[model samples]
Target chain A: MSATTLTIQRVSPDAIARVIDDAPLEPFGLTDAHRRALAARLGAITTDHHRRLDSWLVERGGRVAARFAWSPLAARRLLGSGGFRRALRGRAASIRDGVRDEIEDLLARAASGRAHRGSLGDWLAHRHPAELALVQASAVEWARILAETGATVTGDWTVASADAYYDVERARTTLRARRDLLVLDGEVVVRVRAGGPTPSAGPGLRADLAAAAFAHPDGRAPRRYVGIWPDAGVILAVDGTLANVRAGTRDLVRATIALHRQGELRAA
Target chain B: MTPTTTPARSILEDLRGDRSERPPRDIETAAGLRATLDAELLAIRSVPARTSPLVISASDVTHHGDAVDITHATSGRLRGALIGQLIRLVAVGHEIIDPFDDALRAWRLDSPSPTLIAAYADLDANGRARLATDVAAHAASLRRALADVPSAWAVRTAVRARVPLAGGVVVLHDVVDLVVGSYCDASSSTVLLDVTTSPIGRSATSLLGFHAFVHCLRTSVVPLRVAIFSTATGELISRDVDETWLELAANDVLDVARRA
Candidate 1:
């Protein structure tokens, strides 16, 4: 007899207040204390693992592997514009090992699967010294930015943390998607990309935000999707919509079919 | 399915929302193409396995040119690695090692080509600088391509699919740069993707053609569409595949054999 009209509301950063509680800000309910434990466990990557990876990479690729622990910027500076051997003159048998042990240790955890957040940020490793350095720097910078932006649980976060609150399509569904950070009481979903100069968010990033928001079993959609290029010091905030999620899911489904249709075909 | 049930339409036009339709070619029957491929593979197996005895990738078939453009090849290598990393980042989230770095490291461990390995090991400063710049540019393009991908989708990098042509004697292998979506045993369910730094001549078409038939042989399920993203041009071109198109590609492969 009657059709109720629905009006959409605009989401603003100001609408959400920053939670800066040291008691551990649990957006999706992964207890702050639990997150600290996970972080501590992951951060405690053994020194032996670092030595192994470093040595292994170097042995496989020669000096580039170990020599590349430097950032691209630093590498260019150290590798002055000269003859190849001249550029690398005395670059061998590094009398001084300057590459941070922390970054390497973190990498060891990631490679071992001990550091997988499942639905949070990643501790990605790179082969290029510059790329490796860039990632390490970005992590530090991102930490600083999040601290400045009114969140305390930046180190170990995801949409599915125990402290987090969200709806999923099913109770038994395992979350394969990862969200960078959750704020505004988990109303805002943030995905971070750091390594080089901060770049703009594109279709892929948008699709990711949409999928993460819709898959939320909490039956509630995130108010906003924020893309942060902490390295570039850029923040792109967009209204999260169901359409993007559906589109993303559509692409995802298409990709899956293409990649694994053969196996499924065999099974069928 | 007959043309009555699934009439051929302009797949590229549908995706790009443009009217650049190419005339459809006479297509060979799937059974006939399969027979031809079987016979060729059988003949090859009659002789001792002189060359590599494993899977035959689309690259081997399409990139049969005699002239090896080092720059072109180098570009492809860098682009492939960068794109692979991007896909892994999207699918697995920075879980993989830097493929480029690892590749260089792998080269040292297994020197497939002594000359190539020596060249790399003894790369002059100028050459190395140029390579670094080129690699960075390609890597950036890959990152850009990946950033646009959604996290909810299932993404895989350097995905390998294989099917033996002649009783496992000659295996036709295909390595896709990236694949998005899930494997539903339906015609229009998946999207097969390829990424290239510098557009290789007729590579997109060849890969798409191989993908259509190889997928059918492997899974009996055809992908919904095939796409190629040229990192150099920033173009994502795509086309939907049907039985007719698959037949045409199979015939073209036969033609290559005939000409040879």
Candidate 2:
């Protein structure tokens, strides 16, 4: 499988802007055949056989899934919440100073019969001052990194959705699309990770690129896919090219096939 | 009588140092040290490959006295862990609401150990009260030390540095309790601070060196200084990072790696 070239660098905090700005501007256009193949491959993995494939089940894959808790960790949830996005929209100084208040508001909302059991708000509602401090500290670090990106404080960035594709016949199984933050009107796709780059980071990021392409509204992938690891002080960028997206698709297909075979084996 | 200086104030003064003193950025030294350590470490017998890399932490280097039983959760160990969590809380500007409750909450959030949880649960009311009182005292000490971390310093708590060496054969992991300043600064301005529940000892100093060494390996920039504040006895120990200090740290790691 042909993979997109990956560039990994240990970037200082101040240099993050240059890395994002320097990302390649090549457009990634998908043909009718590509779309059909993606749909068929995704459909084959669905558990159900009779339901139509509708709506996207979007998710952040690779390190994002491993690092961010889909379950109980309140700090990770707060980082990816709508509240965090709103905080980003406010004055930068307010974000640094008022993180605790934001957390308190989230906890209050969770306690007031608004949040479901085991939700982000529920988990936060039970947290003590020390745990809240972790959330606050994480926010401070995140704000510092975002400030270095040189992006406008207002509506330049928005959280991307995780899309799911189900089998047309049976609606039981679903294939979720991997994505995270969409910046500059989806010109650049960003995945915020926790740690440093690893041996599998290249393929994982390509999978992210493929997932983003599959969910693109225009059938055109973003010009660049960027992975930022704030803790490790590193950034990885991959141009959203045809070969790279194809490689990512191949990865997803292979993974799905393996899972499908496993399910069948279990049943037999 | 003159007013007594608090440990936290002393640490802050030492950390601030001479404002006009700007340490030169020595990337070449860091690179050389990393190359030497890499060559020496790879030359040692490699551990058998496994699914996960073998991790080497500061405890691995410092704990040479007695073989700590992995299964037992001692009160001292629990107190240390609890105090460490509280220090992180104070560093982030969180006032300690209830010391024991906050520490346990932070600990659970970070890593919930069933063994530790069961141990804490088994404690009687009096035992639990004593623990809480101890935690409150430690929290007070920590609050004083970390309360004034200037926002401009860009204080980051629980800053972890994981340096995987020998093609991921062994990973050196260390977490600085607090970091002041940024690596992106023009001068050598980054300062690594560690908070310990126990008094600073010989082992603690060595651990500080180990932290500096691993940090340099990860960031390619040596921090200006490394400091440690002990909540146990209100003691502060600090040392500047230099080529000689890094060399000693590299040698210590080599010695430990060879033994392993």
Candidate 3:
């Protein structure tokens, strides 16, 4: 077929997942090229370093991560004095304190555009496999859950190439969110693990909600955040309470820094 | 390939011909057997989902033997996943190198044993040497089986099956090691194979039977044959899924359900 006359067919991610879950003997039936494509795309797609650190924070603070993160008392006090942007900026401080230098160093490097992936890989190389496995396995199972529920996405949720943008309504600042999976009823931000003591909602989902709130022109945000373990088939959902968001943002800031410390931003 | 049959062949081909070794399916007897099987299925479905789904695996049905054997057998399973990756590559037509190098490369991006790459990296020289030799040998055995596999056959690896019972309250679930060809019970259109790293410390034939039974339940069709490849000894045990064979599998499934 002529290139102009040929119509390109794009399979939606949901369609791809549906085919997999429903069909018992599909892989063998598809063309080799399609099978390879599906295989490559298989597994949990969300499990970024920043997300993992937020997960780590969920471990440290447990419920406190939400109480202090969603809308911290201090951030609220700052908001009374300044605009929403200033309050948001104020929220940054609580998070930066625990992990400032690492954040500045890594974010600056990413901003400089040295080699974000190299940064990601160096960090992954040092991490124990269990952590990565937990992240990946959980991601895979979460995908299965999404398919089972017949959830659909309005935008591309593909990782590796996706750039999530979270806008701060008050400050007009945009926070980039690269989450694993986002279910957009009111946005269920999922962070999955294969094996781990299932902690309650972590900083990753909270930060996502925080970003969504700031980004929304209407100031509307995702209502819930999730921490999932696929192997255990366990899910921990925490509501988007203001206090939890404040704590989550705080954890998010620290995680942003930790990822920088963890990653190496140089060419392979 | 999945459990589907083509119209070109007959589902009852095995039972219809006088050339068959297994006894023919007698309609009257089969009718009675079907009722009994359905009753077992209903009994299985009777258990509440809260009491854990009535799921059983080929391994669960297989005799694992005594403790020392069990320990050895268990450890061997840990490597099956890693080795299975190589077999998968072979299935998809990849040229495999030495076990260590190919495994290191293929598993770098994706592997169930997420830390295996690092664990391999952490190994001392002798440890590394031992691992490489063992993996390379196993890889060679799997490749031999692949060579025997028809290129035209559809090869599905690590195929997961959940045969819902009692209307989804209970399930008979398993991850079939590998399934080849398309399948339908009437036609015996598909072939299923399971690969083990070590020699059979236990009679893996029952495991194959479980695989056959699950396939039949998941897709109302019987597989033509179920086989097991012992990579350690390069031994393959295969059984044709006759009506009699499938009936025995039904009995086994019911046995588990009755105990449950």
Best by TM-score: 2
Q: How well is candidate 1 docked (DockQ)?
A: 0.01
Candidate that beats the other on DockQ, 2 or 3, i.e. the better one: 2
Relative to the true interface, what fraction of contacts does candidate 1 keep? 0.00
Candidate 1: deviation at residue B119, Å?
4.5
Candidate 3 residue-wise lDDT at B255: 70
C-alpha local distance difference test of each model: 0.43, 0.65, 0.45
Better of 1 and 2 by TM-score: 2
Number of the top-ranking candidate, with lDDT as the measure: 2
TM-score of each: 0.41, 0.80, 0.43
Better of 1 and 3 by TM-score: 3
Kindly give the stretch of ten consecutive residues in candidate 3 chain A with the minimal lDDT sum: A1-10
Instruction: Rank the candidate models, highest lDDT first.
Output: 2, 3, 1
Q: How much is A72 displaced in model 1, in angstroms?
A: 24
For residue A205, what is the lDDT in candidate 2? 75
Count the clashes in each prediction: 44, 18, 27
Off by over 4 Å in 1: A1-268, B1-36, B43-55, B64-72, B75-79, B95-119, B185-187, B255-260
> Fnat per model, in the order given?
0.00, 0.37, 0.00
